[model samples]
Target: MNIQITPLTEDTIPGFHHVLEEIVREQKYLPITEAPPLDTLRTQLLEQLRHHLQHFVAMVDGVVVGWIDIKPKLSLPYRHVGTLGMGVLPAWRNQGLGQALVQLALKAAAELGLNRIELQVFEDNAPAIAFYQKLGFEIEGKFRRHARVGEQYRDALGMARLLEIAH
Candidate 1:
């Protein structure tokens, strides 16, 4: 399959939304159990774009199958850091789409002058943990019972990588 990776843009919004909804419905990962309303989703996307948040999308034969985003921590003390999120269509999960999306995000982070990037994953998601580890992220900490999944609180592992930016 021909795969292309590109920055998130207005033209790709529908495909991005479709991938997110599929992931959310799968309910095997992500904290979200349901997709947001289209209007709300559009508003949030606009806000992210307006603020210079970095987002990348994986396109398989012209269709978006995955996405990755890293939003800068805007407060004074953490502006150099970016918190990341990513999702891949279930059929494309093991095809390197996730890796491509992440590497693209990291490059964007470095380009944007971000020194550190991180993400939190549900503790039980071993495949995702391994994927992040392979991408040079290290587990920095674990939060106990940090998020609610249905009726139970689940632990989350925080992973981060310090990026070397080109001057």
Candidate 2:
């Protein structure tokens, strides 16, 4: 399949949301098991873009198959850091799409003047943990019983990567 990674725009929101909904309903990853309203999602995406948050999407044959985003802290003390979020469709999981997205995020973080990027992944998700490790992220801490899904609690690992940027 032909895959392309590009910065997300308003035109791509619908397709991006479709992939997110499918991935969320899989109930295997991500905190949101259900997608929010379309307009709301679109507005969120646009708002993020307006605020120096960078978002990129991986499209396979014109359909969004994965996405990565980073939101930088704005305060003086924490402005050098950014938080990351990303996912790939089930069918696209093992084919390097996720890694590619992370690479893009790292570059975007540097462009945004962020010196470090961090992420949180559900600890029970072993593959995700390993994947983040492979991408130069190190586990910094664990959020025990971070969230309740039904009766059980899920733990998340806080991982981060330090970037060398030319200031």
lDDT of 1: 0.89
The TM-score measured for candidate 2 stands at 0.96
Query: Could you give candidate 1's per-residue lDDT for residues 1-167 as a string of tens digits?
Result: 78999888888888899999999987768888898986788789989888889988899899999999999988989888999999998888898778878888888888888989989999999999999999999999999988887898989999999999666
Score each candidate by Cα lDDT. 0.89, 0.89
- Report how far residue 40 has shifted in candidate 1, in Å: 1.2
RMSD of 1: 1.2
Candidate 2 local lDDT, 1-167, one digit each (tens) = 78999999999999889888998887768776589989999988898789898899999999999999999888899999999988788889898888889998899889778989999989989989999899899999999988766677889889999999785
- Candidate 1 residues lying further than 4 Å off, grouped into runs, are 165-167
| lDDT score, candidate 1, position 98 | 84
Please give the distance, in angstroms, between residue 117's alpha carbon in candidate 1 and its true position after superposition: 0.3
Cα error, candidate 2, residue 74 (Å): 2.1
Candidate with maximal lDDT:
1
* Residue pairs in collision within model 2: none
